[model samples]
Target: MKKVRGIYIKNSAEIALMREANRIVSVVLDALGEAVAPGVPTMRFEEIAQDMCRQFGVQPAFQGYGGFPYALCCSVNEEVVHGFPSRERILREGDVVSFDMGVVYERFYGDSARTFAVGTVSDAARDLLDATRESLHRGIAQAQPGNNLYDVSRAVQEFVEARGYSVVRRFVGHGIGRKLHEKPEVPNFVPSGMAGPVLKPGMVLAIEPMVCAGTCEVEILEDKWTAVTKDRKLSAHFEHTVAVTHEGPVVLSVS
Candidate 1:
């Protein structure tokens, strides 16, 4: 297993494996995106993602990872993240679905997510999704050699809060490599101090921002995994596994 630290660059072989793992994750997300629509069972989409991983000779990282028991996190409106796939939750018009996926190839991992609209989503919902995605870019811009992790967090928090949205605090981004959710948890909003470690080149991190249309507070479902906004308002999440490089930040999970 790769050692977990605040910041470190990977070697060429590790980079190659990570690229392959991220590629599978990217393709699986694209497949999931195409299959999501009104009247479609969420589990069907999860099955599609699982099938794609099998076809690619990779394993869904979330499946059996800490007993998650699902290939993908199919979060519908108001659900922040970790929504288990179920046949009963058929997506309907105006519903927003967030698909968070990860894959493991050759013992390396990649993670990413995208929130999609079912059909004819409300303008407010559209703005929330757009803002959440934009916050991803805003956060990634801070992943540089000379910057600290809080820079990334501050970037995400400022952008979302300025738009009257709240960043979910319970489930933040994480460092991922040979294992998913490694050391040095990356928060979407900065903590109250300057103690966060500085980023360095070759550090692979999944920078995901979960933005809530209502309050920042969240609650876990009965399954003890899916996190939902306390006020039942819509939420959006976007993510990309990124590596800090001398040139800039490069997103590993590209589609």
Candidate 2:
């Protein structure tokens, strides 16, 4: 593991607490996946997740973080991520919903996201979800200690691009813990000649892959929060808060 300044590396004890926080997120996500179906309003997701967080004695991490109004980002179809949840925004058959949420437990943060199929989705939609989730795993595999930061970026970019899909360049995964956004940002596409910091044993990151079925280009909607695709094609996102260890990369946000 690299000894780097300015980055917080959790010790085994602190990692245990982080795992507790991540477990809460994991269970909450599972419940959300089951509730994700046709005819369910997007705001319902925010309600359920918030209730679950309270039951677990945790706080919604995104509720007021940067003034985000809801407990979750309930983006649908062409919406890549950070879509505002609304009761008017209802889900229907063949629609794919991306549920992104996080929790604050004992002052530690846990984050994770997943895309779900509401009903019988098209072949193209299925492929997008499959590729995006797979890219997340591919990116996580590179989160091992001693690996450079961009290794995870290359893994995601190559996997998605090779499938003829585009990786959203505007948004990348990030380091998460104690505070929501941490230092040493993790990008999905690592540009030429830019190698990021080395992965250390105590380093914990929220590795996510924001993928698009069309161009990787994206635009911020007038809402000033929602991020959507420029080409208006479907997009999918998957994320996990992972930690680096001497043994390997350990996913913190999984129950």
Candidate 3:
């Protein structure tokens, strides 16, 4: 039976498969975490992700999807999500880069991202990363059955703003399953008078928090995919695929 909610709800069996898919994500992230540092080209990380996907027996969900050429979306410093990877974009000491990716295992998809420090970053950058990462956890904690969808959003905004950061409103967390992106349009901030739909068990959501150190305003680059802070200040992003349950929310992606 279909629920009134506009997103697909996974069953226990499907959730297990999704967990497996996200497990590959976790392993790849753990492997790549050690490789993030000064002098490494952004394209090199993309190569690492592609090889890992092949080794793990899964296909990359982003490569060739909507013309995205690489397995990983590498955004450095001021760039937010969907930054194109390139050999020219070399990491420097004190730079932070956000790597985003998705994988398909047994016909199910899992998507996640993390912002990593290149080497020795400034306190401002470190604090931005901390706040963005924590905002993701705060949002995921609200992904419980019977809670309104934007309850998760509200938590993200409150936690981020309280930490003196701004949450990105254009891009948001989303539902992921058979396809990379599913329905219900999970926003990271609670809009005015919006209660949103109620969460239920078996729902899988990719709760990502994109936080900016300055104004929340963002502008797309001429490339049309890279989103950067309009003020050119620092930004950070973190994400996880979570499954809502009677007990609470189960984070499918972990490292």
Q: Cα lDDT of all candidates, in order? A: 0.89, 0.90, 0.90
lDDT of 3 by residue, 131-154 (tens): 888889889889999999999999
How good is model 1 by TM-score? Answer: 0.96
RMSD of 1: 1.5
By TM-score, the better pick of 1 and 2 is 2
* lDDT (Cα, tens digit) per residue for candidate 1, span 1-255: 234354446876787788888888888888888887799989998889978988998888889988899989989999999999998999999999999999889888989999999988999999999999999999999999879888999999999999999999888998888778876789999888457877877788899999999998999989989999999999999999998788878898986
The residue pairs that clash in candidate 2, if any, are none
lDDT per residue, candidate 2, 189-213, as tens digits?
9878775898989999999999999
TM, every model: 0.96, 0.97, 0.97
TM-score of predicted model 3? 0.97
Better of 1 and 3 by TM-score: 3
Candidate 2 has its poorest 10 consecutive residues by lDDT at: 1-10
